[model samples]
Target: MGSKINDKRESLWQDRDVRFDVPLNELKLRNGERIVEYFSKIEDTKGNAGEEGKVTITNLRLIWQSKIKPRINLSVGLGCVSSLTNRTIHTKLRGKHEALYIMTKVNGTRYEFIFTQLDLELGTQFGIVQLISKVCRAYTSTKLFRDLKLRSAVITPNSKQLKVLSSETIYNKIDGVWNLSSDQGNLGTMHLTSVRVVWHANMNELFNISLPYIQISNIKVRESKFGVALVIESTDSSGGYVLGFRIDPSDRMNAVYSELINLFTIHSTKPDLGVDSYLEMGSSLAFNDHESNAALITTSDSDLKEIDDQHVAHQSDAIAAYLADEAQSKNNEIVYCPQLGLAIEKIKEGFTLESLWQVIPQG
Candidate 1:
């Protein structure tokens, strides 16, 4: 150790007491700071999803910074990835230690993605998340917004929480569960995120592709939670695919703080337009732009009274439905009776930390 190299060498930034496991409760984090979970509201596999439906999953990236900021460092091993599927898809842990790659485009105007869904048995199934651009994109092969839609839904109050997300807030319905991350930064932690979404045909697949790559040196399997994900999808100049990305220290090669400040962070949620009202006044705006904002319903109305009204009505419905179905769920899971408004009283009724070892090894 002759010529030393220590750039403000700080000890490992140990992030403890952070978990992402839901439904399973007693959330815990995993290596590389990855934690995940999955749940089925229906007593069985298929709930009320029927013919006119396509299974889908969505990941809503909530930037904790002042504005919706994406910290992406696109480099060699890790960069932005955009995955797309022409048809609706699902993801399933047919076996343990299985994984896939999804990408999204950072730019909003045009989005294209290539989703390589891993098929251990066959190979990888891929697709694209093409944008219709306007509300009519889905209306006609000749329409504007008919083809442009995000896998998101409103979180109603019936969720049985004190204050659920506002009515205007939109959450991407990520159909499948997160098995593990490419990196092991989130190892040994748990997260309990309660959410419900518009389930799609491909409930087993990851939806909403985005940029940012992580390096996975070791292939490890871990437990998951009921967590949400944000998938950013987009296209390149050649009509190919280019997923969106986050700033990763090990990913971006030409990362500039200035470009990130101008392009990624502030623009992620509320893009810097000449005028805020400009996007709202337009008819061809994206799904979120022209509509009521998901996160912020009305900054003027403090305490979110408006969003709460929407929440109250939905909560009442859920309560009524759960109460009506209480008897049916009593036989299966004592703790969680989705049919009934009342969830299990105890947090650690089913399993404990000691028992986790038993199932963890097998998965």
Candidate 2:
């Protein structure tokens, strides 16, 4: 029986052509945690020239095992990771190499880890980074709730509450920013979850804003003289306030708006479904209707008729142009152009109207 087991192990090693110091099953995992991906020959930024290892990313933690002599093992819990940043490094001989910088918290102390020479496509790296960031955000949010003793602050229908969907750094414009410096806005981190949008200012730990999705009546992206702004209209007990955030990169503002819209839609339709189930159902529904109206909008009218003989292509562009023209006439009215997701607010004094356009989903 011993000889038979040894022979089986040798055969398995020969088939795979690689030895794993720590197998996937051997790694410690929390309940519901699972491995997401594995990458080989990843070098730690602080290690020796020839030091390389295999890196494994689980839903709960990141594990690394050195491949060379003096084997080293390291693990970072996802809950401890604060952020992931990607950068390009230029070497005299190696030219340009992509690197990933991971910021984590250990025993309340912040640490940074850099991994170089990652053999991943740009798109794949981006997707993986985004997934890791999302997991970390959810973990951090749970930790925050626990630390603040506000686990019951969010009133959910079920036990599953405070599932973070996305989080990003944004600037909150001060009311009197026009009279202040250009960089006068408060820098803060924003977290969007299934239930609420939370903002924590870097300078003010005691001051934070949390607004539930139910209170948010409308969300709009607008152009300001200084930069792009996210306009959130809420009807909460504070007598309802319009909050504006000036987000950098403009694209992030759009993403936040889209996420809010999705949350609003899901909350309105399926309030009972938990975040995980809600996401799964949304994916299934989207996959099943792959050739729905959204697909038609992307293809040209001629191609649309060729693909679906029963369907006639609508002149969406023409309608958009007409809407734009009509909006120009109504200078006093704040019109929301469906074609362009912008709220056409009247240009107030001391503000310059910039020609910015973005495509919005057809209502």
Candidate 3:
């Protein structure tokens, strides 16, 4: 079960009367298949007489380290903080059903031992909690397919020149006059679950219990290559201020860029790049071909080097570039799909990037 149990939300939560009881009949979920919901209700309550108000969150982490027979343990702790004032963090587990029903027809040998002990593996409340956790992992992974984690730093390139000022804080870092954005470092907490019951007929099928323990962890992402970098520093007997940023060339952005390049493809045989300069973070170069890629690398720990004239074949504009030598470059399975073409056009029009990322797949 590798999907999204809940999407990324800031201080959003919901509660339900779901039972943590295991060993039950075909359990039906009132809220449907989704086990958790995000941002159900956003509320702020003020405290009385200067007393800090208490808020209840739907997403809370509870750990049961060691368990004895007929004993249920649930320990709670804060995974993050969204408030600053007086905080009263609490954790409690309440049984949704009065009686724990056991199905006589269901057989044994259908459960997995807890992290270590088989004795603590099976129970009414604890077992159900484990199942819920497993379900959550599987559900979320399935919903959100894997994608590269921690897209671009989303900060000015100047900010990356120096690391975060402090290790503990996730705030803006100060480097003299430069405010390098803090690397909050994304938590690929992509709640993942890979069933490994090698002996079982199917991994999804929890043979022993209704719910099994699934692993949820922070994501390990791969670093993608950045775009080609060009250096054009003011030289000669004159000195001037320099400024530049980076071009992400992210997958989504590249897709649109390639689509647009296909337009008026016939007229430009050599190479011509028309760009309206807005932010002066980097030098712009007129490459000889649409299939150009550049990169700015550090000559050392204290210097900058630009990789120019790589002239290597790259994915600049797939559709149009793909037609560079073809009998007809724009005519193919791609252009035939009107819906997809329209979508690509919208991308060239520069749709709100922030809005599009909301639904973009994250690995």
lDDT of 3 at 47: 8
Preferred candidate (lDDT higher): 1 or 3: 1
TM-score of each: 0.17, 0.35, 0.14
Q: Write the per-residue lDDT of candidate 2 for residues 156-231, one digit (tens) a residue.
A: 2353223343331222222211110135656665666555566545444334566655445567766656566776
lDDT of 3 by residue, 172-239 (tens): 22111110112321111111111100111111112111000111111111222322211112111112
Off by over 4 Å in 3: 1-127, 139-148, 151-363
lDDT of each: 0.21, 0.44, 0.19
- Model 3 deviation from native, Cα RMSD in Å: 31.1
TM-score between candidate 1 and the true structure: 0.17
Comparing 2 and 3 on lDDT, the stronger one: 2
Q: In model 3, where is the ten-residue run with the lowest total lDDT?
A: 192-201
Q: Give the least accurate 10-residue stretch of model 1, judged by summed lDDT.
A: 69-78
Candidate whose TM-score is highest: 2
For model 2, the local distance difference test gives: 0.44
